[model samples]
Target: MQTYPIPMVPGPVVVPEAIRQVYLEPYGSGDLEVEFVELVTRTQRRLKAIFGTRDDIVIQSGEGMLVLWSALKSCLVPGDRVLAVATGVFGYGIGEMAQSIGAEVKTLGFSYDETINDMARIEAAIAEFKPRMITAVHCETPSGTLNPLEELGRLKHAYRVPLFYVDTVAGAGGVPVLADDWHIDLCLGGSQKCLSAPPDISFLSVSPKAWEIIDAVGYVGYDALKPFQHAVENRYFPYTPSWQGVAALYAAAGLLLDEGLENSFNRHDAVARFCRRRLVEMGIDLFPAPGAVPSPTVTAARIPQGFTWEAWDRRLRAEGLVVAGSYGPLAGKVFRLGHMGSQADKELVTQALEVIAATLK
Candidate 1:
């Protein structure tokens, strides 16, 4: 496999050596050790801090999508109603995932380059649709967009929606995701995006109301959340745990907290601003539509006018810089520079931008 000096992808980013080393050290069996359970408990506590919620945190062994599916299945039975607010690939995709599970879904979609800025329209849907659950993505990574949820939280309560779900897989540590304050019942996040950890761990902050619905649904599967409720306290997990994975997650969360969440947010914001300014100075067009909030974790730009994505990607790779291409409707038309977690450093972004400039010239 080839590696690049300037490594910037949306996720599964270059894991720092501090986190990489945890995988090498030896430990007792995950299923038998009490110490492992303690590690999970501590990790859960640390994640609660990151999520800014007093709710219980469930740390499961898998990449982010595992919990996304689990959360929907655990809470919804066939014929349940879901209102999915969408702005990009992941946003619209979540709505389809719900439909696949036999739920009746209504997708409130914006352009791929847009965001969920029209809350009045969303509120009307909630008032009329009165769905059982409302789903949204906090950061639409593919489009480099961020949707404000505070008002939706207000709508969730005002309309008495039973479950308000969100996927903050790309924004949690890079930006603010106030789960409790926003009244989000099932707030989903991953280890890879801003935590600088391996993509082996996934977590969610489950509110009491969501848990109640989960219990009543009685869904049982590998991704099920019910077994996890007391799995930690009883020293028996749903499956064999990954002690190294959990420890790396624990360490990763600590790294962000040590830096201070607000400080981290500011760093990501500054770097994003710098990246966009440099791109504009080079005459490159950004992808986010007018009025859409660009994500601090990533910057999406249109492919150079005369260059196809394939050619542009090859040129950058030849220069030893790596970035990501967009998905769905954005494929080939847009590209991204992920500046979150360890890669959020301003110097790193400057270097990445330099490569883009040189390639453009």
Candidate 2:
């Protein structure tokens, strides 16, 4: 039997065989304009449902980091204050990006092992910093931790913060996102993650308040939201978009909607539980503490005492399973098991775990 490498990484997950057909379709036909418009429109509607936002949803032609940067760049000018809440590597990276944009960035950082659920500290930072924008990552994939975005969103509203941003790249389909109800002014996601698509497109949902700020600032070039807004209003793209990626995402969104968002999230939860249980049975300790909220998209576990991450990772790859290694403070000490998108299934997860069990024994 012919075998392929199984990707258990967080993003750019395994694409469903059905969606792969989208790539084989021809591009640049006479119907390209009409077909692309319909694809974009349908994808935007499905994205709104997934993010739970009634606001503007823009699909950008780049990785998730591009949308993250665009969201921050559009809203913030030099000297604007931003309060970034960091629980893991990706959460901290948001703050770094803000700083690069010349925003006055202050991070309220928690330990890697802890979820960002400390409301008291967050409140103190909000009161002291009086930031124009607040940023957080809903699912910190590297540490397998989930932040309390609902509580953070409530705090943002209570304080009347002008802009509130959430990076849900790893959380979008696998977890619940109440963007409108929770007062998330800007929410970002990537197709490569829980959407189960290739890694070429990122998306953002923009609220009216955030749009007003963006319009006033008037950013330019590829990083600007104005061009995307123009494209949306006129039903044309700002620049040449990756039609292949667009088609693939359209098909992927169909798969997600057909399965229903709630059902998809429930499947992720069940798969995560199964993965965690199997890891425990294999005598591996999970990274996040018992009380902390762990991410349903991925599971972070401590590497076995006798083996290094490099050694174990090599072994897993040799067995045709490609898991992820940790970053930041946990580099080489922790390994991650991704159960997102199409990979969040009992059969696939069981196969990967069986490999781990055999290799470790």
TM-score of 2: 0.96
- Which candidate tops TM-score? 1
RMSD (CA, Å), each prediction: 0.8, 1.9
> 306-339, model 1: which lDDT tens digit per residue?
8999999999999999999999999999999999
Q: After superposition, how far is residue 65 of candidate 1 from its true place, in Å?
A: 0.6
* Every candidate's lDDT: 0.93, 0.89
Best prediction by lDDT: 1
Q: Give the TM-score (vs. native) of candidate 1.
A: 0.99
What's the TM-score of every candidate structure? 0.99, 0.96
Q: Which runs of model 2 end up more than 4 angstroms from their true locations?
A: 1-5, 29-32
Compute the lDDT for candidate 2: 0.89
